[model samples]
Target: MAGLELLSEQGFRLDGRRAGELRQLRARMGVFAQADGSAYLEQGNTKALAVVYGPHEVRGSRGKAGAAAGALVNCQYSLATFSTGERKRRPHGDRQGQELSLHLKQTFEAAILTQLYPRSQIDIYVQILQADGGNYCASVNAATLAVIDAGIPMRDYVCACSAGFIEDTPLADLNYVEETAGGPQLALALLPKSDQIALLEMNARLHEDHLERILQAASKACKDVHALLDQVVREHLQEVTALLGK
Candidate 1:
């Protein structure tokens, strides 16, 4: 708030986005030929790649392969050593990476129709090639697109977004500067059609009175993300169809 103005008097954010406005989103599916499914996405300055594999036999010990009643879901989240302004010592294997990986697994487990592939395993790996803000949110959205490209069954499309509350206004899709402002922020992942929440996380506490408004703002942002992702999927399908005819 001191070094940078998060919200100007005109209601524009540091990046010139209005309250509840998301950043520019560009995405493509099937970016990789070998993986079962792959996607690359850019949300403002943040870029991520997601690759999905398996829905086949488990790789490790059967005891750790999970229950036969449902498929095992595994996720790994990594940030490139140079993804941020400061270089990282390791791409992963750290405490933050481990936590994000667990969050991703839980989010996918709630969305993917795991029962159909009982005793099998599905692996999703998300890497942050560039970091702005909303790293977790971008990862979720990209992973969802990758899963769709892989032809995996799911209850609905999963979408995610991050929101920050300041000056009694909710700012959607915060950038690195806004995120570092030390304000109350919320991250959400949702199955838009069913309005089911796959994950919800909050950092810094907001007044209870403003919680609902922040949630609603984040939910709307997720729907906006879903629309963009759906369009990308449609375009990818059309291209695939055209290639098949050739």
Candidate 2:
């Protein structure tokens, strides 16, 4: 942040996008035939894949406690070793993965209507295929589609986005370079229809006055993401309907 200027004088970012603009979003559902539901999504250079299984009978002590209340929503979030330039052992077997998994669980637990599937378990597994920032957002978005494809009912679509503050401007959908610029970064998951937030996390500190601005940017980005994902779902359904009619 000291030596590098994250924003250009021309009001552009390193990726050539303007502040408050989101990266290109592309997604596909029903990626894996074997799984109950599966989806793959890419936002800029970051890619994520998610699969859903169950709504079947609950198993293990981990799910037993929640069995009486509602369906057990178990999630696993993993970043592939190849996802980043510098390869590490990976997060699936480590603490970071566990934390991410918990975050995802919390995010979905708020949106999904789990009460209908009492004594059952729904497992969501999401993995990052590429990393260029916004990993958590992409994972949540992809998993949301996977659960939808699985025929799981939820209150509304959960869309996620990331934001950063730079040069007194709030930037939406930060990339790897912006993320490394040592500025305040925010990640948000929202339920668009209800205008409700499922999860919100921020790293670094920003002026109290600017916090609301960044949140607005992030919220707008999430709503934009919801539009994209909703289009994908509608297209997928149309294709499925055409095939069934033939």
Candidate 3:
């Protein structure tokens, strides 16, 4: 909130974006031929790759294997050593990485129809190749695309975005600078089709009066993400169809 002006007099943010505007989003599915499903996505400067596998017998401890209830959703989130300006000694196993992994698991559990694969497991692995703000949101979006590419059953697409409050304006899709500005920021994931929220997290303190505006901004951004992901899925399908000579 101090070093750089988050919003200008003209209502533009540091990146020349409107308060509710999201950064450029681009994604592609089936990025890896060997994986059951894979996707690469870029949200502004944050880049992530997600790979999904399983719906097979659980790996590792049989005791931890899911019972007759539903498929066990396992998520692993990691950041590349060089992803941030300061390189990390290890990519994962840190407290932050573990926390992110749990968040991912919870988010997907709400969207995926895990009940379809009892006694099996579904694994989602996401790696951040670049460190920008909204890494969690980008990871959620990328993982959703990978899951779809895997042909997994899901109630609906899960889309996510981050929002921040600055100068009485709710900013959608925050960047690294905005995140580090010491303002209240929220990360939200939604099942757009059903208008259901999959995950919501907030950092810092925000006034109750501003919560609604921030939530609305984040919801709108998530819907926009859903549209882009849907288009990518359609294009991928068309390409596959053409390749099959259908």
Candidate 4:
């Protein structure tokens, strides 16, 4: 808000969208044959790939089951070494990547209804091919599609979006420039039909009054995302059906 110009005088955001508009979303499910499920999603220039594996036996440390009575959702969030402007040294295991992985696991666990597959693990791996803004949201959305592609049961689709509060206005679906400009950013993952927020995270200082507006913007963005993803899935199913007939 201070040094960044988020909205133009015409009320258009940096990407020339309205306050609640999301980036162009293109997604493909089952992109890989090797993985149980995989998907690729592009939100503007930000590209992400998600792969899901297992609902089978736990891979490591069987002792951690802890009588949980449900499957474990394991997530690993990694950015390609060349995903950013400057190359990163490692793909994963860094502090930020590790933390993101944990956040993703928690977020998906809320939506996945893991109790359906007891004593197993579901792995969601997200790779950021480009680092704009809203990487977390993009990853989560892609992972949701991948899980669905894998034919996994879930309570609902987990759609995510990022919002920035700048100059007393809420901007939806921030880019890297807006994100780096030091405004309060809120990332939300929601189930559209239920209108339940599975995950909500915020950074920087924001007035309590403004939080609702920012969250509203984010929720709207997530729903928009869900619509696009639904369209993609439906189209993909149609194509598959046609192919089977052929």
Q: What's the lDDT for candidate 4?
A: 0.88
Q: What TM-score would you give candidate 4 relative to the actual structure?
A: 0.95
lDDT per residue for candidate 2 within 185-221, as digits (tens), equals: 9999999999999999988878899999999999999
43-108 per-residue lDDT for model 4 (tens digits):
978899999998878777863574158888889999998888886488349988998898898888
Q: List the residue pairs that clash in candidate 2.
A: none
Ranked by lDDT from best down, the candidates are 2, 1, 3, 4
Between candidates 2 and 3, which one is better according to lDDT?
2
User: Number of clashing pairs, model 4?
Assistant: 0
The collision pairs in model 1 are none
TM-score of each: 0.97, 0.97, 0.97, 0.95
Clashing pairs in 3: none
Candidate 3 versus truth, CA RMSD in Å, comes to 1.3
Off by over 4 Å in 4: 1-4
Error at 86, model 4, angstroms: 0.5
In candidate 1, position 6 carries an lDDT of 76
lDDT score of residue 22 within candidate 3: 85
**lDDT on C-alpha atoms for all candidate structures:** 0.93, 0.93, 0.92, 0.88
Per residue, candidate 1 scores C-alpha lDDT tens digits across 1-246 of: 576777899998877889989999999999999999999999999999999998888887863546488889989999998899896488346889999999999999999999998888999999999999999999999999999999999999999999989888988888898898888999999999989999999998789999999999999999999999999999999999999999
Preferred candidate (TM-score higher): 1 or 3: 1
Candidate 3: tens digits of C-alpha lDDT, residues 6-25: 89999998889999888999
